[model samples]
Target chain A: MSYELYYWTGIQGRGEFVRLALEDARAAYTDVAREEGDDVMSAWLDGEHEGALPFAPPFLKSGRLVIAQVANILHYLGPRHGQVPDSEAKRIYAHQLQLTITDLVVEAHDVHHPVGAGAYYEDQKTEARRRAKEFRESRIPKFLQYFEKALERGGGRHALREFSYVDLSLFQVMSGLDYAFPKAMSRHDVPLLRALAKRVAERPNVAGYLASDRRLPHSENGIFRHYPELDA
Target chain B: MSYELYYWTGIQGRGEFVRLALEDARAAYTDVAREEGDDVMSAWLDGEHEGALPFAPPFLKSGRLVIAQVANILHYLGPRHGQVPDSEAKRIYAHQLQLTITDLVVEAHDVHHPVGAGAYYEDQKTEARRRAKEFRESRIPKFLQYFEKALERGGGRHALREFSYVDLSLFQVMSGLDYAFPKAMSRHDVPLLRALAKRVAERPNVAGYLASDRRLPHSENGIFRHYPELDA
Candidate 1:
């Protein structure tokens, strides 16, 4: 049985979070658009006959059943992939953490595109400057505190601390944050969270993928981009 | 056999989502804050608690384990309580829908808060106006299209064609939107979605919940507020 992932091929974007989970698990799958091209992604979503997948990017097709949402995809891949725990409770807990990470990801995306995703960041620069400041100030602490507590509550060691799917996502998010707000993150002094990112970076498969060509470097095109003005 | 639901007592807020599901199942549960008071909600989260129940309110406590997140709480309650299906694939699909609902909830919240939840909506009114327009226009259609397709894809007249946990969420979201933006909703004729909302509203358990004092009425304090200005 083959697995196919449909997403915007180039930018790490939302799909990267799913990719990290699969890459870390060494799961067999195809990044459909990355290889086949956008016509495929477009056709895959808006083809004739009106039969399209649910939502957009980061959908996983396992046989006939197609699943969307980044957290949902990871939740599906986690158990089948051996990346998440075997226990039902543990799995659900990991999913909760992943969902929280999704919250953080949306916040990051908004820092740049506070007006509208369809509109250019330049078009929304005035509003974005306002939104980004608040994001760096208020949201980071509120969301991160919730997560730091989740790590603490979920047994704070790693983001998952027990080799769960959420940890991989936490790593990806932290990486994105680092790319986007290096100064802010450095000043924040979240030592444990930094350590957690370092630990996930050291994972054998993840580390291998990071070093290999398959992994894309964080860039301005992605959700988390380094804009010095926004960071401050 | 006792269920304890933990959430901030005062604001019906996100906790209400969980309340709707439990009430629909007609399950026996205690709103912990309602019984235990505000201090208990704070104390439950305080302390160097690792693997603590959940990151925030709207958590469910069954004996020793504390389940958190509205979606996660519902996921835990769905199968055992019969709000969702028993099959693993169906369960995942149920979760996919809930996660999408969660995203929608975030979007709704962002409309008022825009950049910061800690700040007042009036403070962000300028930004809110811009965000609200996008929410009413773009986000509504995007989410509606996906859910409408999911209902269609479920291969029956009903969504998931059966009463799943997501069906209630879809119904609730539609209710929230209608209340929040009656003018906008009235202008746009989303017949498929409107039909789904009606079906969910007429469900035996849900109908009972809406009639009972147990279900909180839609208000300005919650995610979907009926602000006339934002409606247009």
Candidate 2:
């Protein structure tokens, strides 16, 4: 059966990470929410759907099991789709790296919602400006350098011995950041990560997916947003 | 060999989640950083140690493998320590619940540092107040209600089929929230979670650990900090 991926319709958001993996694996799947309005996704969030209850979206339904959390969804998909190795140690290592990416993603989202998600961006713009400065100066470099080092340690190509789902997610992160913080990212030096993103984008399936209508562009509606005042 | 857990000293922070699992299972382990010093943990973070490098502490060095991320560490420890069942399906379910708890924990920390981690709480007091209000009004109850529903679905006592690592983490979260926002939590309704916390605390092994000096008190230094103004 084709995997049923459920997330909000408009923005790529966290759901893109799952889409990238499925796309790269050439796996058959349906973007349920995008195809059939968000009411379908809302029903799942309201606990109308069966199986595990997700606190938020970007959940995947494969057979009877439904999984939430981007890293958790990727962890399950990695081995099954040949995105990660079979070894237990390697799998957990890949998950650890993915979790680090999750941390950075949260920070990226918080830059615009610094006062809290309940408030509008316009109301929190002052706070976002302060938080974004620190994110661009310290947080971005720290996380990017860590990924660069991990890529180096894993053979300067893939994040592990072989190209895995992590590289795909990293590819998404680098792309989102570039779109969101072009000026700030231009000043940073992370050659290995830059190269990995380039390699991931060139892969046949990923390249095809990127050109298709399936891939959504980044905007203020998503986690990584472009606010000229918030970037360098 | 006994597990060597590394985390920052003084503050229970994220490391306490790993510590709870070990204590509940009565597993032999050393709180390495607390005993040795921050230098040891810093060296590991600085890539001076072997195996996969950690983004931050609360990493466990078990024989040849070093694991990071609280949920990932618990996913590894749960089965071995008899904290979770043997089935892969049940284990992943437990991990999914733990990941939800992880989300709440991050928001709890952000309440006091809404402007970013680089600034001091005093420096960001204005923003923190705004963030904390929304956290108390919405985020806290929303997460607690989800856990309450989860507990009800899981047979009303533990977070899963049996007393697992997820339950232990839930207990920690309940206690931490109560410590950080007593006034707000008092007004909220989460009977199942409150009862679950009590039951987890009364567990023989968990009880013994809590009574000892090993369990640290909550304060401003950790994630769940109580600033009177931030509470209801």
**For each candidate, what TM-score against the reference?**
0.93, 0.99
Instruction: Give candidate 1 regions above 4 Å deviation.
Output: A47-52, A149-156, B47-50
When just chain B is superposed on the true chain B, each candidate scores a TM-score of 0.93, 0.98
Error of 1 at B132 (Å): 1.2
- The local distance difference test score of each candidate is 0.78, 0.92
Residue A85 local lDDT, model 1: 76
Off by over 4 Å in 2: none
Candidate 2 CAPRI-style tier: high
**lDDT per residue (tens digit) for residues B27-81 in model 1:** 8889878777867877666634445435567778776666777887888888887
User: All candidates: CA RMSD in angstroms?
Assistant: 2.3, 0.8
Error of 1 at B90 (Å): 2.0
TM-score computed on alpha carbons, candidate 2? 0.99
Task: Report the C-alpha lDDT of model 2 over A39-154, residue by residue, as the tens digit.
Answer: 88887777777678888998999988889999999999998989998888888889999999999999999999997899999999999999999999999999999999888888
